[model samples]
Target: MSAANAPTQSQLEKDIELIKLIRSRGLVPLITAEERPDVPRLSDVQGDVIYGFPKASLNHALNIEWFFFFRIADSGSFKAGLSNPDFKPTSSEDVKNNLLKIGKARQEAKLSGEEVKRVKLQQYQIAFSKTGLLVLGIQDGIADARFDQRCMRDDRVFLGDQGKWDDLFDKPGYNEKDGSAHDVNNPRALHGVFVIAGDDDKECADITEKLKGIFKSSIEIPENGIVQGHVRPERHLEHFGFRDGISQPAIRNLEYPLPGQNQVDPGVIVTGYKGDPVGSKRPDWAKNGAMLVFRKLEQSVVAWDNYMLDHGQDYKDVPGGKAGVNPELSQEDGAKLLAARLVGRWPSGAPIALKETSLKDDPKMGEDPKRNNNFDYSVYDVPGVSAQTPSDYYCPFTAHVRKTAPRNLDPYVARQYLESGSIIRAGITYGPEVTQKERDDKKDSEEEKFKRGLLFVCYASHLDSGFVRQTTGYGNNDFFPITGLVPNNHGQDPIIGGPPAKGSSGEERDANLDAKPAKPFANGDQLDIKLKVPGDTLNRYQVTGHVEIQPLTQAVIDFPFFVTSRGGEYFFVPSIPTLKTWGTAN
Candidate 1:
């Protein structure tokens, strides 16, 4: 690299300080950065520092993760339990330190040509709900209005929930049928959730039982001691048979990101840092902490499979299929292709942006880190494929992944939507694999014992700019990414978007897979959508020849809500030092 391109001496000093900060917090910098802003150490951040435990340090298999939800019965005892030196919550710093130790041991053993010793490992993290904070006398708000709301149940309107929330979301006596809160309005059902993760389920269970015993008097433990969740036997695939956790955001200073992974500022995921949406509005205790959104999303696997079987080939008619004629793909492959379009990726996690190779599930390309996430929406990254299909032709605008993260198209939208609104997801799939009988019947089992879904967990600096905005502004909104483009022809996100509320005025809950450039103007002409915002005219992209005008401008499809919200709660993951302060009475 030339001297001009090389990092400056000041940048090197900052990097050294960043490394020192991490080491001080018992963490090792896995990937070095040329230049990084001063960020909080992993020691102060709770939960998985690098988002979900996709893989363990040195390629160790991640086995299972558990969520232990409880209610604080006695504030004094609860505070005392938190203060107790014996009670140690999982810190990302310790997890990284363990990883570093394992890596070192492996390196030493390799040099000697001998076997390496197995290092025992476990991860633990703790977070409290708004009610949890209230029980501990934290009357001061955490600079997030959405986090401070009465409950997630009440905030469902913003998320477009159709009142299908699970009964567990309700308080002890609240009724689900008639929408009666009873006393639920007074106090939220759950106080907080304790996260325990490791390879050994037995060890995690034992630890959970021990903690329950310790905090028995302080909190009310559920009858089922731990809500166990595990990575599926099918590897990275979720219950619905789709690969998840594929496109996690890479924090600027925290991780060495892959080719096309979105890199965000530390303030996007953690508080009291540069670029935080709330800026200096946060309290001292909330520094290094993050706003956590937890949800129990139940997936109807059989129903989803049936939907795929019935409508998988629907996308064959979408305007820009290769060479303008559908490929001679099998019915099964066709269904799988449709599913890929809906998800914006194949079952193996290969993005549909590479529509040529992605016509069939490209396991080789999906698993390759260098290639899996290498393509932006605008630029087709596949070699030998020179098709310049723009205007949501190759990939739908409402596809789950595109709706969630509209890469390269950020310039057309509001400022900092990608940077400030992104979240660090650390969710785990819950429940057993689907039964053959359920599949045969084309529906989920009526029995509650056979229930399955995701224990969705994510962290961000501010709720409004992060989770809420992404869900409401992008996923749920019809005309998002392009305002006044063919009216409500563009649809809501099929996978994560909520259904329309009952008794509401005309709100079409469908997805438009094929959206061509509206007419009078041809392919190369600028899109005629209304531009009220500044900078909209600066980066207008000209359409390529591959964008064919379809017969119907509003080509809407009724994609059922295969994933339904069972219930959820918002929590605050406080810093380590702030947690220690809870032990002493104010």
Candidate 2:
């Protein structure tokens, strides 16, 4: 065929590749099967695989998760369990099918004027930690050298070793004296983790029993290794009162795109995709696999709330304090503003970058899908308000969102280099709600003393640039993005950043705010701003400088750790076909 007249690959060929990819790798939420109108739906893709992502099932009210630490007593028995058709691993396809059936049932019930009975379907996924694979003598199956290296290393070193932990201004319980360390003995020795999520407690318990039956003879469940997590009754808020999972990056090559979401290349998440940024080619068997980083973080609700109560007034001294813009703010309201600044968002999940005034009282703004998660840090004015100068002056550079994502604030080279650092977070909060009475009582029952936090889970293509860099590089460092205006020895992330030195008491972290620039006014001088109209050819303003407004600067008191790491592990979620092969392997 002539080069100019050569035919393009048919839609059927593309569909086959897509199915093979989904089957080999897992499908996440928001992926659509039909990307192009010309493509005829394949039977495999149309049936059950075409449904919604399992982790994001809309009808799921409560989710229960269990992390199992098991040792393989007999490889043969383990393989037998893998071979059982009833115990086969749940694929994204299975989840989709279940959701479709449930949706249909609900619709039929609604049409018949009958109550839609809750479906008690249980969903489960299994992943092997590096230790689990080693225990099973399957280390050779891991083809990525980075995964292999990280898998072999302890998570303590990845997060913060004894030295790094000691350097923090406020020491976490896990890093405290041996007898007092939280999670000191629990998650560190785990071999593998099994996650079971369902609609309610009964479904979760049933699934747990089924899992026990599969590995009863081949593994040992550690006393404390099994942890449970559920969605809070308030919906998406975490223990610290911040809305989470709201700013996840959208994956490209999906069937559908979420409105206002920025889509990243598939290589940023899935292995073997063209967007994979690593220099080396992944192994054949490792194709379609993803690296999973798990962490059990406990949040001290009392301590966090206490810190805010004690230090809220100090926020006014910090740069970018809204008191400069809104002179009517009280000390209490200023404290609330400070709390919002530390979190990078208001309690309602509204990004501070979206408005000049604190949206702490405006819950509706934060709840509006069209407003939240919509602003970029590089812009100065609110959307549609172009008369103001463009800058990152409103939101502090070290704000949690800015530190993690940076968006246009990052240098072009660094931005491109860190593309692989993007990851998909699939975590749920664990712990009971502490009542106001409990806080005032100053005494916690034994059950209330039980640690509560997030079961942090994230999937990435590479550990080094993904989770590792995001933590050790960005989360730990104070002088990130390297903007010239940032002060020397600036403060680390207040919410998650560790202190500069260990064993220190009452230390403070530095933050620089890009306060609105001001010019000096002489006695009897009047100020006037020529507002730019919509169709003005040039949007420009000139302010005469008698004295410039210095950037707001302040130090935050370093308190005891609020979020402490309990345990974690690295695992590889492989293709179903690979699991089948392992099931039959000698």
Candidate 3:
């Protein structure tokens, strides 16, 4: 069913003219020999240039497609290095084994085949390297600081010469008024990051080929075009285990007919949501600007496993406390249930609690719009009884989705109606599947396991409003199951928050951490559910054994960040002032 009638992709040409007129304020598009395969390094305009989203109709659209990107800072030694023990890079066989284990459990529970993929992903995201990557800390501006001393820039900066250094990441934010946000605000700054990936070596080569051609050829767009990077993050499956990106918007108004779906109000991604002031209040150069934040967080499986061994029984997989002593649930089953609560869906993408761990894949029912988004958190809020026992029974308050956006439990009416899942994701996994040798040597030490983790990137309009604030403060609170009443309820998102330590929190005593963090639940569900769990139960487990992170100096990150940035920069993907002004004006 063609649910949408997207505009013919004849809009890319129009965007070119406007961009040529403004020509990115600070950052220069590093047209490498390969990227500029069609033309020489500095080719003159052919007849006319087009820009923006050729995929959509640009007629009379005020919003031009903005290109938000971070050039990799390091750009060296592009190796996956799975032999290293740092990330515990799971092998192809290991992935298959884990999948098999999850599949058997689902089958025994009677869940269908369709739900299996979801469970596989939960395991995958944790065990492997992440998709988008980022770097934090200090360095001189993005340009190589050592280059200046090496005399690479002596010709350009002091000797009044024409030559410059080959350094990357040393650029400024764009500003028309003062014309300075680049290297001038100066020195190494904390750089945000993102990237597209390949199906294999060949696919990446194919993308590189396409990109090289595009950067070289100057094409035309219809009106004012926008460029949205689309990727298939599915060597496994789509996010949350469904064929996502299908439900996303194509054209603002023409294609999308839903209410408030015309265009996300500017405030959605741009900063200054409700009362925040705009433009003038910002720096002279940042008038219509936005900053992106990116990070490469590695999930620790060993720690995560240890926590589950101690806490899995509360969910019916094991008995609470002392894994060796408890006779009820097997260690394996406990691991299974713990994984289910954190993801809100079983390995099969089935909401186990919704269906009581039947493990059947209900595609039509699972993917249905109203039903898909329809879980209510209110029933869990009540003190005495839950319409369904085990309030966080199916999903924990600390699960990824629940912590990010508390569906239905609208604390602030305004934010509730508006909250969308965290900013757009541009990611690619690094490192290979785990190997048998690494698995066997798992106990050797933290330094002997995996190479990398997810290189996660996010697009944000502002620092406080986007990535920085959430991961730091709001991202991991645990008060989700309790609903409307709890103190400082920004609970920990179990999937990303790292694991709660052994013998701490209800997850230790009860599989569900959904109960109010403030108000607790007791040991058993059938006999008596208590209003509060004692303070002794909730232990704070260590999130990660992070790799050494180099600091950022002079605004640009120093050479060696955890993600090991290669190269990247900020660019203004412009609107169509060309046909209206640039083309005619020139």
Best by TM-score: 1
Q: How much lDDT does each candidate structure score?
A: 0.68, 0.56, 0.30
User: Quick one: best lDDT, which candidate?
Assistant: 1
Instruction: Report lDDT (Cα) of residue 121, candidate 2.
Output: 63
User: Given candidate 3, what's the lDDT at residue 262?
Assistant: 16
Candidate 2, residue 356: CA error in Å?
5.0
Residue by residue across 22-122, what tens digits does model 1's lDDT show? 22111134444233447776666775644444332133445688878888888888888877777887676666555555555565666899877556666
Task: Write the number of the candidate with greater TM-score, choosing between 1 and 2.
Answer: 1
Residue 372's lDDT within candidate 3 is 39
**Alpha-carbon TM-score of each model against the true structure:** 0.78, 0.72, 0.43
lDDT of 3 by residue, 1-586 (tens): 0215222334223222222322211111221112122221111111001111111111111111122222223312111111112322122223222323433444434444443222212111010000111111112221211211221121112111111211433233422222233232233322221122222334334443443233222221212111122222333222222222111211211121222111233333333232122423432222222333333334344444455566666554211224433345566666656655665554433444354332233555343432433454435533564554324534555655455544444443334232422333333333333445545655212342353344344443433344433443344333333444433243455545433232233232323445465633332111222333457576544221222222242122111011122222232111111112222322
User: How well does candidate 2 match the true structure, expressed as C-alpha RMSD?
Assistant: 15.2
The list of candidate 2 runs beyond 4 A from truth reads 1-60, 97-119, 141-146, 151-158, 161-189, 278-280, 317-327, 330-332, 356-361, 382-392, 410-414, 435-438, 441-449, 485-489, 499-560
- Candidate 2 lDDT score at position 95: 60
Ranking by TM-score: 1, 2, 3
